[model samples]
Target: MFEKILPFTRKKHVAGLKCAFTGHRPQNLPFRFDETDERCLRLKAELRKLIVQMIEQKNVTHFISGMALGIDTYAAEIVLDLKSQFPFITLECAIPCETQAAKWSERYRNRYFGIVEQCDKETILQRHYSSDCMQKRNRYMVEHADLILAVWDGKPSGTGMTVTYARSLRKSVWTLDPNTFSVTVE
Candidate 1:
């Protein structure tokens, strides 16, 4: 009955409840990578608040995480923890490449793959690493999300680039400071 609706002309499925996450790796964070670190614990608490806001205030039901080491992994874990309360919320993993975590430590690699296994969906941008794969993954998240949750230090980083790209797309970005555990809309 709708054969005339061309692919490009057809209305896209715009998810009203979509959010993406971006953040710096462990080395870039101001604190040690241990979850028990005071800094890490504080950020985890704050992230729980933000995700709750997204669910209760913004009606965000779908979350996308890049699954990187430091902040991204923590954010994904928080979302997974919240799933028991917000049963409808879904997590999606956007990986840059198949071998993205090849060089990571065994523990981190296992964590990354575990999260990937639990995600509702995964989009692998490339089979192998390319200079632009990360950027491409960032762009995909920006294009798909209604909002971006970034853990940035207000410096030059891939996280910063993702935030800039989200802003350019007219997507609202909530930036979190790893140093002070503060969130600002930029």
Candidate 2:
């Protein structure tokens, strides 16, 4: 099962210019992950730069977000902010299940809805959660995207799993460190 790893250069080679995002939650952040935290702000800034590069430099027009908290939410917001400049850009929310955020605090839930409301498309995986639902969502994004922007800390988790799968599928993966804010392409 461990074969067929290919290096991807850019999204332009794919059928459509599409990309996806994955990352750790706020709790996994090295510094305070609060909205106003300096580290968090810096992370957002780095994400903004990368998103812009995807749009202007890489010719990516569509972005898929899992809609999870932390990097996922931040990435989605950055794409939305970029719409004013790249008006043709589109955001697709690929939710794992209807109750995917049911356990989140009200604050996070509100933020999630706000992002979803503005998304160009929404694909809910299932009506209820399953043991494999999140994995399925990750696969869905990887299967649809030509590239994946991953905010990871070189650790083993869902984000890492997605990155590994992306590489196996020969999709371009850009990994960003939550602590250092550096992006390395694989």
Candidate 3:
């Protein structure tokens, strides 16, 4: 597996442009129910538009998603939707563990697993599960991506850690503040 690891470089490459996604798990009921309220729906639409614009402007050909709840799942959905218009677009599922899906609710678990099955590629970080291993998976995503798409609510949490790691790597990052709907490029 160590031999399979590749160094991530600053220069854009030809195989595909990869963007990793991470974000806070939505705390509100709207996200819990998997039903988009009016505000969330509007925000989701706007996010989709911004992502598509970025894909076009940056010539992104592949999107890598951790497939965690909330923002990661949403980003994958958006990229999958865009695949119709950009046939070359591919989604890679970077799952934290082999059995992580078992922790989610049946509905959500099925939905997430379905996406993983449908993705162009899926990379499971560990054969077994552990709290620390999840963190390692997040770090792996940050290390591999050329860019990061983050959804932040201006709080310190796991998503913050991801943002910090991306910054340290000097990878391009784009963020959407859930509270303000303002997009920031870092």
Candidate 4:
């Protein structure tokens, strides 16, 4: 007996503006592990607002998230949430490694997987984690994006490094201050 095979259909690519996200993990955020905190709620609101602006005003059709534990997770979720209203928008998760969430708590791991499941695409940089795997992921996103949205506190960290790298490439970087709820472009 012959077995019938179905053709693989790839997701359509919409060529347009793209944005990448970079931010501190939960350990660096003011409301670490407290999603219910007022600061966290407000930060999410602001992130959602900027995403809407990107979709509506800037016509950005694609968003890349590194899938880190804090801001990356939040940004990816925001993009997925906006997909209902802006159906054309797509989210791509740039995972540093296959086991990126292996050591996380069950709750966080579940959330990460949930977001990954809903993202339109995922790019795994490497099969295993290395010292520079995170930087590699960050560079990949920055190289592929037209703009970088960073939630930073003006301190030196991975997020700061990503911002610096993006700036070095002359890419537009919009930085959001987590403490002040203000945005600055570089």
| Best-fitting candidate, scored by lDDT | 4
Query: Could you give candidate 1's per-residue lDDT for residues 87-163 as a string of tens digits?
Result: 67778888888899999989999999888777767778778899998888888888989999998889998998888
Give residue 28's lDDT in candidate 2 (0 to 100).
92
**What lDDT score is found at residue 183 in candidate 1?**
88
User: How close is every model to the real structure, measured as TM-score?
Assistant: 0.89, 0.90, 0.87, 0.92
Per-residue error at 3 for model 1, in Å?
25
List clash counts for every candidate, in order: 0, 0, 0, 0
Rank ordering of all candidates by lDDT, starting from the highest: 4, 2, 1, 3
Write down the worst ten-residue block by lDDT for model 2: 1-10
Clashes of 3: 0
Off by over 4 Å in 3: 1-14, 28-34
lDDT of 4 by residue, 60-148 (tens): 99999999999999999999898778777888889888999999999999999999888877888888989999999999999999999
**Which candidate wins on TM-score?**
4
Model 1, which residues run further than 4 Å from truth?
1-15
Candidate that beats the other on TM-score, 2 or 3, i.e. the better one:
2
Question: What is candidate 4's CA lDDT for residue 80?
Answer: 88
Tell me the lDDT of candidate 3. Answer: 0.77
Better of 1 and 2 by lDDT: 2
